[model samples]
Target: MVLNLGLLLRIPVAIGFLFFTIKASGQQRYFAEKPSISFFSDGLVEDITAANQKVTSIFDALNGEIAFLMNVKDFQFANKLMQTHFNEKYMESETYPKSSFQGKVTGFNANSSGTQQVKAVGKLTIHGVTREIDVPGTIEVNGGKLKLKAKFLVKLEDYKIVVPQVVWDKIAQQVEVTLDFAYRPL
Candidate 1:
């Protein structure tokens, strides 16, 4: 009698647990479309005096594959040396071509409101090397959209990128990268 009642209660609880788990898993699999990401650089030394400003990288976020496309022609410099050296020696844009972050937003709430700080942990690939990085940023939901802003530092050595000795002083060992995203639900 007592044992039979316990078993009867346990069965329904187990079923309930399985139902919720399936629903949660389905929620995570849902995908967002066309999330945009952009990055800027301000580390050029000689170009500082020449009033050079460059905005690079406009990446698109798909379901799984994050595609980053940056036009080399978009970069501007005061002199030919800076342009040639940046593309060939420093960035090696021809060889590596692109940088990307493939990851998911954790604890994301589609109907969430106000300001929330979230941890975004994922693999960041740059210069042909991949590293696991956890970045903390605030997500603001207002007017039915998500606004995200985060700034983090990535070390050059972690990506096996060598800073030439001549301009070592000009570049910082760690590069500060910032991200600003405006996402709308699909």
Candidate 2:
């Protein structure tokens, strides 16, 4: 049932991502300082969440182009053990220290005020793996500043994150990811 649910959600998102990736290109760029990304996992045994506020991104307001960079080691969790395991075991932070996303926003307009619905299509790289994704989110422009937020799901196995058999039930197969990027014009 869970597998079916994921497939159902992924199809439309994939289609939208392809459309937006193509639509965003060649324009003036905007940049985000100290952007934030939060990762949440709800498992039968435990719910784990972590936030990284040291993210940096470059985005184009006119053409909808965007790119984000972050350090995996910078992600802070609720406890030290989880953080240690995530870095040394699951994420192999020593081996793969950085993660990034480079993409474009579809149908973006900086001049427009209020909140606008948009689709972001880009390549998200984590733990040395890069995958193409398209996700729906909202962008709010108030008095010239821009704010972008989105939430998406990622499968651990797809990124080659192998959990030990003993702790399989303690972890979730999918992780929910959220992003909050506040941009400043250059």
Candidate 3:
């Protein structure tokens, strides 16, 4: 069979038009300027709190897609020994150096200029364990800037974080996690 010149010419034209349409849709991407995450655990013997400010995050305004990646060892604690234990024993940061979440935001409106309650449905991975979770949060858009805030609880058993028997009274079963991120257009 012989190739048709007219059909071959139309194929390239169709591909070009598809790319133009996608480009005209204006997919807005935002990058986090300073992302912060903190966790608190109240135990029988002691209360622990730690914060990490080196989290990286991205958001897509067009599709409501959001993602975050953070180093497990970046968390800072008031007690140095506790921090060491967190990285070595609980999180095993050497094996799983990074924790991440990838998901989409539900009920997000790009045109809204004020804070709106939204839910993120995604997979959260911690200590090498991945779980699908729905987290409630707020999105505030003001003066061309975007801010995200959320507070949620995490169960140690769910993430497979094993605590030593000796520190049973020092660690809690559930920990409260908080996130605050300010984003700028990319």
Candidate 4:
């Protein structure tokens, strides 16, 4: 008996399928059901701080793909008036209900232990505007979990978040944004 050309072709195809399956099955995924996003605006009148807990995000340990979803109205402030102004006046939450970020972590390796520095470069959508940015962040992997943290400054004008002249000085020209997420295996 001799091997046929058809059989040789099928052999390579089967091997390729097997390789992909094994590779995908061996790699793990991580996710954050409830991430935390905070923004602080230090103003001349008073300091304003707001936080949102209903942020959802996902991370692929093997591919380093990262995504985040945040509801604009979910942000809570100590002062209800401030919250109202933020949603209605600044963010227009009703018009733009959601904010998102889609980016990748370069050279991300979850198997490595300790802390690692990575830059998330992608589009960040806020206040009905999208801009490409590179955010520096750190990821700490211990045991079976990974904790990601990042902080950066965002200019309100960059996203077309206009601040009225009346309260211009009351609010900071730039806003400080912070992200904290704890991811578990998926």
User: How much lDDT does each candidate structure score?
Assistant: 0.52, 0.78, 0.82, 0.80
Candidate 2 per-residue lDDT, tens place, 6-95, comes to 222234444633443344344344456548999999978789999999886656676576777778999999898999998998999988
Pairs clashing in candidate 2?
A: 30-59
Of the two candidates 2 and 3, the one with more favorable lDDT, higher being better, is 3
Give model 4's TM-score versus the native structure.
0.84
Question: Candidate 1 overall Cα lDDT vs. reference?
Answer: 0.52
Stretches of candidate 4 off by over 4 Å are 1-26
lDDT of 4 by residue, 1-186 (tens): 211222222244446335333444545666674489999988998998999998867676766777777789999999999899999999999998888887778756776999899889887999989999899999988888888999999999999999999998788989999999998776
Write out the backbone clash pairs for model 4. Answer: none
Q: Identify the runs in model 3 with alpha carbons over 4 angstroms from their true place.
A: 1-26
Off by over 4 Å in 2: 1-28
Instruction: Please give the ranking of all candidate structures by TM-score, highest first, separated by commas.
Output: 3, 4, 2, 1
lDDT of 3 by residue, 4-94 (tens): 2223223444463353334435456677798999999998877999999988776777777787778999999999998998999999999
The TM-scores, one per candidate, come to: 0.61, 0.83, 0.85, 0.84
Please give, for residues 27-131, the per-residue lDDT of candidate 1 as tens digits.
Answer: 312212223343344465732212112222111122222212234334555666866776688668788765556555565555568888776777777777879
- Give the worst 10-residue stretch by lDDT in candidate 1: 51-60
